[model samples]
Target: MRLYAIGDIHGQLDKLLEAHDRIQTEAGHDAVIAHVGDLIDRGPDSRGVVEHLMRGRDAGRNWIVVRGNHDRFLPAFLERPDWIDPGLSSGQHWIDHPGLGAAQTLASYGVDPGLDREALLREVRRAVPPDHARFLATLPLWHLHPLALVVHAGIRPGVGLLDQAEQDLVWIRQGFLDSDADFGPLVVHGHTALDSAAHHGNRLNLDGGAGYGRPLCAAVIEPRGAHLLTGKGRVPLVPEMTG
Candidate 1:
C-alpha cells in the first residue's frame, strides 16, 4: 500500500483539495493519506478544510491527521476564550502570528470576529459543526509506519519515540532540524516552511509554505522509497539540506 503524507494545510481549502486530487490520482488503491497538521489557522477557509476532511473520513477514506502547534492552540481558545496565555490569549497572538487567518476561519463558520470574545466564542460554538470539533479533538500527534514516522513537526533527537515529549513533536524546530541521528524511521514532517520540500537522509519536510501563498505538498511513500506528488507527475524525492 502506498502512503501519501500531506504537509501543513493552514486552512487553504483550495490547495488542500488540489493536493487531495493529486494524491488520489497518483496513489494506489490501498493508499493511506496522512496530514501533518496545522489544518486550521493562517489562511482562508479553515472551516471548509476541516469539514472536507471530516466528510472524506466519514466516506471511509484512510486519513491520519497529526496535531500541530497551531492546532494545539485551537482547542484551548475554543474551550476557554477567557484563558489568557501565549497563543491562546485574547486572540491577539493568533492575529499577530500564524493565526492571522483566524478571522477568516471565524468568518467561514459564520461568526463575526468583531464581536466580543465571550459572544464570539458562543457564536463559534453554535456555528462550527460538532463533527469538526470532534475531528480536531481526536487528531493524533504522530503516526509510525514501518518505513515512515509522520508528524506535524520534527521529533526531538536522542529521545525514544515513545518517550518524546508531545510539545517537541508538534513545536520543535532547531534541535530536531539540526540533528542527523537515525530516527528509526524516515521522519516525514511539516512545520518549518521552505521554498520546496527538504529531504534529508533521515527525514523529509513537506511544508512548502502553503500558509504563505504556496502550494501544499504531499509525499507518496512506498516500500521502495518516496516521491513527491506534483501537478506534472511523480517527482522522486532527493536528499537536500534546507539550512
Candidate 2:
C-alpha cells in the first residue's frame, strides 16, 4: 500500500488541495493520506483547511490526521483564551507568538485576537462551531503503519512507540531530532520546518515551512522506500546517516 504522508499544512488550503490532487492523479483512490498535523495557523484559511479534511473523512476517504502543537493551541485557547503553558515555548501564549500564528487562525474565522479578553473569547466562541472544536480536540497523536510511523513531531529516543509522551510526540525537538537511534520503521514526521523534505536514516522531515511561505510537501512511502511527491514529479528520499 502506498502511504502518502503530508507535511504541516499551516492553513494553506490551496496547497492542501494541490497536494491532494497530486495524490489522486498519481496514486489514485486506494492510497492512504496521512495529514501530519499543524493543519491550521500562520497561513490563510485555517477554518477552510479543517473543513476540507473533515469533509474528506465524512465521505469515508482514507485520511488520517495527527495533532500538532499548533493544533493543540486553538482548542486550548478556546477553552481559556488567556491560558499559557510555561513549559511549552518558554511561557509564550499561543496568540502572543507570531510563529504560533493564532492571530491568523482567528482571522480565518472572522474574529480578532486583538479584542479585549472577554470580548475576544466571546467572538471566538461564536465564530468556532462545536463540530470544528471537536474535530481539533479529538485528533490522534500518531498513526502507525507496518512500514512507517506518522507523527507530527519526532518520537522520543529509546522509548517504545506506544510509550512516547504526548508532549514529545507533538512538541519535542532536541532529543529526538539530534538522536540517530533506530525507530524500527521509518518515522515520517513534520514540525521542524526546512527548505524541503529530507530523510535522516531513522526518519523523514516533510515540513517545507509552508507557514513561512514555503511550499507544502508530501511523501509517497512504500515498504521498499519513499519518494516525495513534488510538483515536477516524484523525488527519491535518500536517508542520510547521522550521529
List TM-scores for all candidates, in order: 0.90, 0.96
| 1: Cα error in model 2, Å | 2.2
The lDDT for every candidate, in the order shown, is: 0.81, 0.89
Provide the lowest-lDDT 10-residue window in model 1: 82-91
Q: Write the per-residue lDDT of candidate 2 for residues 1-243, one digit (tens) a residue.
A: 778989999999999999999999997865699988999999999999999999999999999999987888888888877778553756778877756788989999999879977788889989998899889989999998877899999898888888988889988888888898878888899999999999998999999999999999988998888899988999999987764
Badly placed stretches (over 4 Å) of model 1 are 84-92, 95-100, 241-243
Task: Indicate the TM-score of model 1.
Answer: 0.90
lDDT tens per residue, model 1, 110-130: 888788766877888888877
**Top candidate (TM-score):** 2
Candidate achieving the largest lDDT: 2
After aligning candidate 2 to the native by TM-score, how far in Å is the CA of 72 from where it should be? 0.6
Task: Output the TM-score of candidate 2.
Answer: 0.96
